[model samples]
Target: MSTTRTILICSGKGGVGKTTTTANLGIALARQGAKTVVLDADFGLRNLDLLLGLENRIVYTAQEVLAETCRLEQALVKHKQEPNLALLPAGNPRMLEWLKPKDMQAIVALLERQFDYVLIDCPAGIEDGFKNAAAAAREAVVITTPEVAAVRDADRVIGLLNTQGVQPVQLVLNRVRPKMMSNQEMLSVDDVTDILALPLLGLVFEDEQVIVSTNRGEPLTLSDSSSPAAQAYGNIAQRLQGEDIPLMDPSQARRGLRARMRKLMQTRIF
Candidate 1:
């Protein structure tokens, strides 16, 4: 059996942090001494390169590699800070018209020979883009927020993944607001897992730092930042490597937030 783990990071709906998770998770895995490459399969938007700060460095893409105009080594853009991680840029949006499952498989097959992990950043929604991305993946990570619409969409995607024979699909609940969840405002983690019927991989809190990092074209895991989302991504990477780490509880998180707020107020008062 091939040891390369080709995982598709997908979400059935947009705006659910799918690309963000892919970028962070790729960096996290690389930091842990894994040879990881993130393949940008979202040809329409192709934001993975931007998120990884390799947008300007992309001279060629998977299209050129497959067309025999350029070699695979010429097409891959390695991360400047993290040498262990590299990115395979997606083909032009026009490739979607003629991109077959075999073409995706061919690309992934080439990648599998060199890397320990191939993280495919799938396009959002259950459409042609999603189908093409899922075609080459051996496993999948389904990202969803705590919103009802996102969860509903995730459940449908899970069913589709099952039909496609993707094994051991996991869920990562992103943009979770502990206060709202504790107050019965947003859907709880259990609510989502119950509906999707997949193992919960990790829970990322709604952090403002995520926006700051993305705008700066840096992943939180790249630096030793103390961001909760960064830690969550790292933990998710560790769990993916078969490490035993405890999941963070929303109630505890809420309490920790209150404590931090109290400490800040007291510092200002004193």
Candidate 2:
């Protein structure tokens, strides 16, 4: 039997790629032979279904499951590209009036029985929606960007998670611009990690292909996606599966051979 693990993917603010991370991670996990289900826990403002390209196929939303109008299995929209992956999309905002933390927990408990991983795409902010998203999560992955405001908000969310007894809140830094970091205009990985003080999950640089893939409603973790963001998401999924993979360092990749050699020589023992 697969021991289901629930992970809530959250951000302190919006536009930090929280849903993007959840979508890609789900696809990656599915590719790795894990049965994964991603929930659009943003409730009234569902976009995960759109991201997974299953918007048209979503005949039954989570609201229907909560209302007992449909079974949970009926509400799951399986990925066309990945059979092992499924999505439980958010429901109507008006119908979500009766949705509570316990309701979320019950849904997660049912999902946990069947899949290896259940990733909840949490809504932005610290409102009731946040609590509902975090309620049944056994773990959390906080998403942030290389900006001051995002980092600060992430820190606040981490504190909230800690107080709520969410164990091992990992950090995934998204939209990292290495050029800005090198120019001292943006927060570096070290800077963000220092401030957040959370275990680093992964890093995704600012890649245009990510936006293109989002617009196309196909996650970049597809078999054909060669974008840097796609590889970062793959790495994160491996790490989540307890694989020891080094985080992507875009700055290192941009360095010239001479610069790399100089740094290597400066740090060499012999």
Candidate 3:
């Protein structure tokens, strides 16, 4: 077994596909044979379980574990098909008022002992929820879109993570539209990376299949679906495993975008 790693998947703003990234990444990691557990730190507004298609099997939640009503392991809902993956669902949202970061720290420590990777799906914004989610993570994956507001929020979160001493804070640029970039209506991968100035984990193109998969309660990376988003997610998972997979292009002009991101990854610069 490899050493355990706890990662917080968060964004400064909502609707940037943070939960989607966490769900797919967790499944992708599990598909690679890692014992992975995704914890929903969003409290009352839990959505990770739904994304993983395990919402119906949630017999217990993180709140129950914390309240001593159930053991931590008892609260875990195993993936129906992916044996190596499981979910720790969020409990009552009202619990957030009293939940502290140290409590999260303990839960993360316990989960790390049993899983190779603990992925925390953090709530949006820089509030108590974000602090509690980021508290236990040694590494953070900030999710953002190409819009100026999202990028600015991500930069703020990154700065906050730095202040919290989280090392190797990586960025996952999501919902990239290639055609818009070509028309100069959207920021290019280079534009986003230049402003963020962080190590690039991967980039996901805007794919309608992602929405379809989520609606079907399935992960995009579960099969060789050929969805550009699915392929991008697979590459991101491989990169997370420290593999040297080439960055993918999520646009109609696929090769160009891939080459640009590939060059950036190799050169460690924008």
Candidate 4:
């Protein structure tokens, strides 16, 4: 199949679940028969392999290609769980300068020739690793948790994406607790979308399953079934396929307007 899409999952701050989003979205896309790949561009701090349960199997990473030890295709590890999905791990112990922007373009350009979609897992912070990931993808997904720090960083990343001429900065709000949001205690969907001024790809509620799944090196999207967060990510995958999937409302656990209005005020005054 011809590749026509590339998505870079990025965050200006750390601990915002960019890797997790990249992995699961790739799974979701692959599930829909889209030949997909998640490139771990977080050189020297790679974790997409571990997140996808392919850590131990990664012998040749992206670093190998940049170091001239192997070709780009030589480093890819097919997902143990996702038949249609594959992963390209990051740096190697001997290769520290693996974050070069051209290497990323070369690798992703090669991937685009074979896969339908390539999702890049960007490193945290606006540094060399981040630039490498941005150079590989034509579009971007800014992942942020509904917290002060993550949101601030996400805003900065969105600005950078725009500056790069990356039209359409998509937002993925992760780890949201609607109960707190409704209580006017946390940031709501509106709060984040308004500040970033971007289209929302998904809203992942704070789910215990996510942490549990991550620890097992599995993405929640695989067996999301009735899980709200899983369902949200799945819908996001469908959207990427050019389908107009309707957004699902978070469970009462997500709360209602009284809480949303409260969240609005809390964010405004802060």
TM-score of each: 0.94, 0.92, 0.91, 0.88
CA RMSD of all predictions? 4.2, 2.9, 5.4, 6.8
Clashes (backbone N, CA, C under 3 Å), per candidate, total 0, 0, 1, 2
Q: Rank the candidates by TM-score, best first.
A: 1, 2, 3, 4
**lDDT score for residue 239 of model 4:** 83
Q: What C-alpha root-mean-square deviation, in Å, does candidate 3 show against the real structure?
A: 5.4
- Model 2, residue 106: C-alpha shift (Å): 0.6
* Greater-TM-score candidate between 2 and 3: 2
Q: Which residue runs of candidate 1 sit more than 4 Å off their true CA positions?
A: 257-270
- Which lDDT tens digits does candidate 3 get at residues 1-270? 438988999989999998899999999999999999998988658888788888788887776787899998789889888889989865666666767888788788879889999999999989988988888899999999999999999999999999999988999999998888878799988899999999889989899999998988899988778888898888888899999997765454556668878867899554
TM-score of 3: 0.91
Task: After superposing candidate 3 on the true structure, give the runs of residues whose Cα lies further than 4 Å from its correct spot.
Answer: 250-270
Q: How far off is model 1, as Cα RMSD?
A: 4.2
**Best by lDDT, which number?**
1
Query: Worst 10-residue stretch by lDDT in candidate 2?
Result: 89-98
Tens digits of per-residue lDDT, candidate 1, 1-270, equal 679999999989999999999999999999999999999999778898888888899899888988999999999999999999999976886656767778899999999999999999998888888999999999999999999999999888999999999998999999999999999999999899888989999999999999999988899999999989999999999999889999988887867667978868889674
Candidate 1 residue-wise lDDT at 209: 96
List where candidate 4 sits over 4 angstroms from the true fold: 66-68, 251-270
